[model samples]
Target: MPHLLPDTGPQRTLAASNFTYTVGSGLFLTAGVLYFTQAVHLPAAQVGLGLGIAGFFSLAVGIAVGRLADTRGARGVYATTLVIQALATACFIGADSFWPFVLAVCTATAAKAAGLAARSPLIRHYGGDRPQEFRGYLRAVTNVGISLGALLAGWIVQVGTLTAYQLLIIGNAIAFAASAAILVLLPPVEPEPAVDSPRWIALRDRPYLVLTVLDGVMAIQFKVLTVAIPLWIVEATTAPPWLISGTMLLNTVLVIALQVRAGRNVDSPVAGAGAYRRSGMAFLLSCALVSLSAGTPAWAAGTLLLTAVLIHTIGELWHSAAGFEVSFGLAPKHATGQYLGVFGLGAGLAEALGPALLISACITWGRPGWYVVGALFAVTGLAAPLAVRWAQRRQQAGKGHTASRQPPRRICQTSPP
Candidate 1:
């Protein structure tokens, strides 16, 4: 049996971290289900548009809040954002009209983005040098929470009406509030600011820019798998609706089961680069598998979809684990939030563009649209090994430069907290 508790640090801190992530995931999953339910009542294009709007707002506000966390301390920012998220969740419950729903989604998106920005940096703060493992553990715990939320929502939908959606929104509010309370119990650790750390100026850094771009390319898969795949299954196959739900459950279960081991393996000096390379390759393979759906017989399409989902879930695990480690490792201590916020921009853009891209591809290529997505993934995947090599050389050069110019500094004891 897998151990429920992490082996590092004080149990209190680990428990608190797990609790906070659980709450955050619950909010996200709940909001996502509610958003889809609302979207079902509107036109197809409207769904994409609404999500795009939310992503845009989230990207804009998340950057600002990330800067705040870097300068002011993550605890304060996390607590404040969680409060905002709770309010936004409550707003969703009250939102009956289209405009109201839009407004609520926008607010919730921003709140969640900001909260995540603050929370991620804090996780590193607490994990110190071993952030890779800590982040992996964090992801696993959060995935468990997300899985629970998804499962609960599914059950509620079966036994209840749309009103169950309201209850989920309310539950999300409570979860955010609970996270805020937990964050309050942690000690404050303020990060120093970088010189001339304006948001636009930060973008001028080449390495950061490259990482962001790479991440953006990866984001396309995220958006499609999460949104378009379910729709495709429903429209093109005889798969039971629960197949999609099962796929998600499988993803969460795998993360929870293997994330710690994956994190450790990925962080090894010999395997780290290989792990990064494989993430992209796995993603491409999964996309290709999904594309095969276009050629599947109707009688066999359900099995094909299930198989595709399994491949995609494995890709998710590899990419997500590596992505977190790389993001945290590449960031400078003083600019954690700023860099992370920029990293998050890729996700925002993906969420905004993924649905539109899928729709456009379908219109232009019909069933072969899946192939187009697969081709994109393949190209990106092929670039991964090259990117990893570049990042490694850059890090080595940076280390050499820093060693050559030994600056006077106080004794530093670096641990998560």
Candidate 2:
């Protein structure tokens, strides 16, 4: 916990703000679907469909808003997103039907995506010499905040009343508002100086785009525990129901403890690529282990499942750390917000599509699907180095071109002599 503390003022402020926001996010993540289905009486299918649609539309918002942050100012833009998120969240209480629910969820999702992009420049600016490492620290802080929020939310869920759910929603909105207020304490991060490049430089970077696609593919692993594991435990294995929460608790604790430490070792794009490779292999092995648990005795099944989760969490750490390094390191300093926003599209896509994919590939298809999904991650990890190399080469070439375009220095002649 001492290691999680920031050494400087801006870092401290950002950490505080992030912790506050994620606490609210944790509440929503834990109980938001239930609020729609149980409280509002919306069908479960409608909730999932609305969230999917919202997630899809929200992808573009990040890029647009992020560009605005780079051109205008990140601090104000980011704060505005939080205010918008607060409003949108409050509106959830009023969404009693499908369309209203969709509208409210979409607005909030878009704002959340935009806020992430807008915050990138500030992270780069105040992150000192090792912004990626600092990002890891914030992630650790985020897990702590979310865990706290989830615990509070567990109480709300246990109450099992519409009013209790509404209070949770309201509490989440207030947290968003409070988080924005906390950010006011930080010194403002100025806008990036204007450049003469194309308006959508990140979109135009083909190598970067390719890397984004790969990252998006790999991002499916995030849905494994959230969507697939619980279903698998119930349908395929003889493990107890309590293990669902237990596994999540274990994952959360490990992330909070080791994410920063794992990130420190992955300092460059090459190392990041290597980390990805290792992460993919870990995912593969974990998948195999999980598959073996399906037809086993109760004791063996629980053991295998727990072992798989431990391996998967290690892969998660590596994947997250590698992502931070590659995303930040490859981006141009002046266009950090735009690039990071573009990078976020991958995760956004994953959020929208990964659950369905995982369900089909892993659960529906049964145990063999696990190996197939694991191999996909392994292949994606193996491809990352090649994509990164392509991006690096292009960056170098672009720099060379810029240098060549500079006018030659005027040679002064001694004509007077």
Candidate 3:
């Protein structure tokens, strides 16, 4: 735990910012939907539709915003996103109708996505020699903060009052504002030296795009614990329904305790690809365990489900670490934000589409679906190394071309969240 602490002032500041941001995220994630459906008295379908529309719109905003961050400045752009997110969240209380709800959600979601891309440069600059490792530390901090916020949200949900939910909204907004405020403590990070490249090079980079698609597919595994596992426990397995919360608690604890440790050794792009393969295999095994729990006795079912969650969480750590390495290690220094923004498109799509895909494959289709999903992950994992190698080769080719024109310098920047 001591080793996991951020060593530098910048790292500490960034970690503090991440912690505050995720705490607010946890609050909203745990209870925001309920606030809309119950406190706002909006229809559930309308809320879902609005969120879906917002998610779709956000996918297109990240690249442009990220490019803005690169040209203008990361800290300012990032702070702007946080302020916009705060404002949009505060507007939630005023959203009575579907259109107003859509407006607020769309603005907030776009800001959130844009913030992630905009902050990439800061992570790269402050992360020192191994930004991926610092990302792991931040992930650990994020899990801890989110867990605390979730506990608070649980109280709000238990209170079950309009005022309590409204308070949750206000608290969430304050958290975002506070997160932005913390960023002021860190020194500003200037944009990297510009390179001669295409206006939208990330979009044109086929190998990187291939890697992005593969990573996006693997990202579906993220929804398994949040969406499929809980639904499976209730609809299929005879495990006590209480295990749903228990499983989530277990996952949170493991992530907070072990995320940095698990990612410590996966330091390079090649290593990250290997981690992806290992993660896929772990997910496959966990899925099998989950599928077997369906027809078991209560105790046996509970055991299998718990075991599955443990394996799944481990895979999640590896998957996250791999993504950080490959995304950061492969991006050009000058276009870190734009490349990461492009990288985010895949995850954005997965976030929007993963739940439906998981439901259809893991729940609607039953046990066979779990196997199908597992196999898909395994195959995706198997393919990652190849994609990474292709990216490496392309990177080398670009480096060679650049060297012919001028003195050689490190072109592949190594950092991002």
Give lDDT: candidate 3, residue 387: 96
Q: Give candidate 2's root-mean-square deviation (CA, Å).
A: 0.9
Report clashes for each candidate as comma-separated counts: 4, 0, 0
Positional deviation of 51 in candidate 2, in angstroms? 0.6
Worst 10 residues of 3 by lDDT: 1-10
| Over 4 Å off, model 2 | none
TM-score for each candidate, following the candidate numbering: 0.83, 0.99, 0.96
Q: Give candidate 1 misplaced runs (Cα > 4 Å).
A: 1-4, 8-48, 159-163, 193-201, 238-241, 268-273, 294-299, 362-367, 388-417
On TM-score, who's better, 1 or 3?
Answer: 3
Name the best candidate (by TM-score).
2
What is candidate 3's lDDT per residue for 79-110, written digit by digit as tens?
A: 99999999999999999999999999999999
Ranking under lDDT, best-scoring first? Answer: 2, 3, 1
Q: Write the per-residue lDDT of candidate 1 for residues 1-417, one digit (tens) a residue.
A: 236455545334645555654655664555554445552355545555666688898986776788789888887887898888778868866665567777887888898888777776777777756877877776777777666666676665665566666666667678777877776567787677555434554465566667677767776776665677777767765667777766666666777888777777676432544554666666666655666665467547766776777777666666666677677776767777777887788777877777689767743456677766767766665665566667667768877876777877889888995
Task: For residues 303-341, write the lDDT of model 2, one tens digit per residue.
Answer: 999999999999999999999999999999888889999
Q: Which candidate's lDDT is highest?
A: 2
Candidates 1 and 3 compared by lDDT, better number = 3
Give Cα-based local distance difference scores for all models.
0.68, 0.93, 0.92
Q: Lowest summed lDDT over 10 consecutive residues: which window, candidate 2?
A: 188-197
Residue 157 accuracy (lDDT) in model 3: 98
